[model samples]
Target: MRISVKLASICLMLVLLLTITTPAFAATTNPVLSVTGTTVAPVASVTPTTATAPLMPGDTGTVVVTLTNTLKSPGTGNTTVITESHQNVYPPTAGSGITTTRQTQTSSSDGSSGACELKFVNLLSEGPIHVQNAAYTDVGYLGLGDSAQFQFTIKVDDSAADGKYYLPLKVKTDNDECYVNQVVPVVIDSTQPRLVLNDAPSKLGTSRGNIIIDVVNYRSSGINSASVIPEGAEFTFKPRAEYTVGSIGAGEMYTVTFETSSKNATYTGNPSFVLKYKNGDNWHQTAPLVVGMEPKTDAAAAGNGGGDNTLLILGGVILVVLVLIGGVYLFMRSQRSKK
Candidate 1:
């Protein structure tokens, strides 16, 4: 009877211990996260989505990025993924020019959107940090019953150089490769003319001096060379046309180096002929060349040497008219006396 009672007591103790420790063991053995109290079910996975236009030019309207974290398991905390920031803007690159890098604090929600204009870059002061880059701040994982989504939008630099710009975004979860790279093609465009004359304005003379034309790619792809028209002013050689850009890509500046023969035309008015290139469309702009001519006659030569003679001659004509008027008055007075 004593043996029986001792065996029964041992069995009872084991059962009691199992009851107490079973729950604790189960808790310890469970995975890091557990869905308790509520039912757990699987849902559809989230596939990445890309924008129609990877990026928007400063001149081209606006770009909006819609990130759908459609995963059923909502993340615990919201994450700030920076698509682009001119400066350290937590979100997108501010349209702000180089004078001031776009900052998250200065985003459209707070500051004026005009601050993001790309035209204000300080080319000489200090260049903006270019190429592609990305980062993520402290954020949380998806919670059991919650969801998080972020909308990324930014104004592309209208003047942004054309290149393969790679933008990567980091999703909060490490389980899946959440990084998605969006290859953005930046197109160069401008309402203003792209071809500009960098040649010194003072160097223009009646004799066609060497003219340097800096050509910018506003549309389509890069131009290999700009084929000029006419034989006299614009030719392939003699002046030796040189371009800053030999192999120009989209959003690039190519320079044209060529010289003109001395201005030998009869008329001395504005001598402007259209600079044309048949890349695809008829691209043309009036080349700004100043033609200086030495006058042939002594009077014309003297006029050139002195202040504007045209104004002086007008003043002299006015003086002569006044003297004639006075003489006519005196003659009339003498006739009246005689009468």
Candidate 2:
């Protein structure tokens, strides 16, 4: 009978222990849950525009770049949340108490949509070109299907060669997560129009004379609104100081004439001519070309042969008058002797 009673107690204890540990085992086996949300990054396009004419050596100009956000939808950021739990149970009896423990964890993420934040924009100088302005910082945000323009002032070195040059443009956004690097092309041309004296009189007399000059365009491009001006110390140009030559084409030449008169007959000085023309939207002037002019005497100013002939004829007339007077005096003296 005592054995039967001990067996019953043991079975009852086993049942109670199972009932208390079952919930703990179930809690320990519970699976963790995770959720995530993601959005695509924004895309941007860059385009550069230059002036109508190529940049001349040692010239200062501006370069314009247009930035467009090509993304149809706004960008979104990621967010996450985590949760955890623990459970412990102690057995109801004995020298060493049994322990049961359970742990649970969960995670979730959320995203928000909006414009793309641009951190900075920079233009890097290369070769003979130099950027005058600093990098653009804290450029604000760019929305979907939106465009922005940025202009940079640049100067070309005087020794820059004539050819195509590329400059690097860098852009950063989304806390430097997104980056863009592109090359912008530009042309450098140092050629300009040249003016030279084609045909001119060696000596300008007191009388008015024609001064002809040749306008030569050495550049690979055409120029318009062309004009020429005459400069001298003792000369006056007619009909105007500024003579309009209209247009000159690439590798072409145009001839212009000016009626010039000397202010003083004895003046001996050098005269110069200047050429002005518009290349694209910019006007340029060439260095003055100095020409020497020698003064001429009045007799030399006239026909050389005619002046010599006039002087010979006057000498002959004086000789004939003197001979006739001498003959008359001799005739009077002879008449007196006869009386």
Candidate 3:
């Protein structure tokens, strides 16, 4: 009986020892993975820096995005983050105006057994704007106090008008479920100068004369280095071939006078008026304008000179007949006095 009691006591002691040592071994081998007191709260943000300025048609630009993780400890494995963007219509470089949509992903963490993530950002344009590459970019991995940057290539639709576009972006993390949304503005500066003829003379004489022509700027922007030139072979100008107009503003007008004459002998028609101006760094010309013209002609040579010569000859003949009659009368008077 004593032997049986001894064996039972030994078994009980062994069981207790195993229980205490097993936990200690486990504590040493595998560290606690979960954050003790503070949870991993990651923070993220996005910036559309390119939107501050304007983009012209066929212009290529970039939009930047930044992400940061504020986690206290590394808890999980790799976290997936996605960034997505969409626009109402594609750029003009594309065949036609179509919808643009894109997505990208990244894995970010706090390092040392932590996870990292990236998310999609939605962007839209009021005008026709498109994304060339994927709308979103992958940052790969991000650690604690670590920041990641992504760049997106965007194109302004070639057919987009001069205007502003509002694009909103959404950022999210797959692991933490954290999200942020931001809106950025993009301006389009691809407006061409519009020139129109205003307050122009209805008629211009073919003789060497000066006439005023008003060049109107009908566009929303200003026209610089403007000039007007007559575009007809039948007309010539004095002082200069082209008249200088300088600059004109939207809804404003500038007038210039050109000394012009007809190159032809006799002609009556309009003279073409062309507007040349500078827009941005390029020069442009407008459609030809036709003005009324009455060319000089020799009316006297046509018939009036011959009619006057005939009248003069008839008068000379009548005067000579009167002179002869007077002479004969005087002779008869003298002869009678002598008798």
Best by lDDT: 2
Candidate 3 residue lDDT tens string, 1-339:
756765654555454334221111111111111211111100113233322334556565555555566554654433445343333444544334444444344444332434455545444443576655554545344555566555555666667777666566555555444555655555666544433444444444446766567777766556567888776666677645787778787678776676777665554555677888764334567777766655444662446567888889998999898999998999999999999
Per-residue alpha-carbon lDDT of candidate 2 for residues 232-336, written as tens digits (9 for 90 to 100):
878888856788988888799998888887886656577788998775445678999787677555555467769889999999999999999999999999999
- lDDT tens digits, residues 1-339, model 1? 756865654565454334121111111110122111111011112222332322223422222232333333322232222223242223333332222233222111121111111111011111111322123334444433333333232333546653434333333333323333233222333322255657633323446556556666654443333543323342222334322333445576666656544343232233232344322222333354433333244465566657677778989999999999999999999999999
Better structure of 1 and 3 per lDDT: 3
TM-score of 1: 0.27
Find the 10 residues in a row with the least total lDDT in model 3: 35-44
Cα lDDT listed for each candidate: 0.36, 0.67, 0.55
Supply the global lDDT for candidate 1. 0.36
TM-scores of all candidate predictions against the true structure: 0.27, 0.59, 0.42
Candidates' RMSD to native: 27.5, 12.1, 21.5
Deviating ranges (above 4 Å) for candidate 1 = 19-66, 74-136, 139-185, 188-267, 271-339
Q: How does model 2 score by TM-score?
A: 0.59
Q: Rank the candidates by lDDT, best first.
A: 2, 3, 1
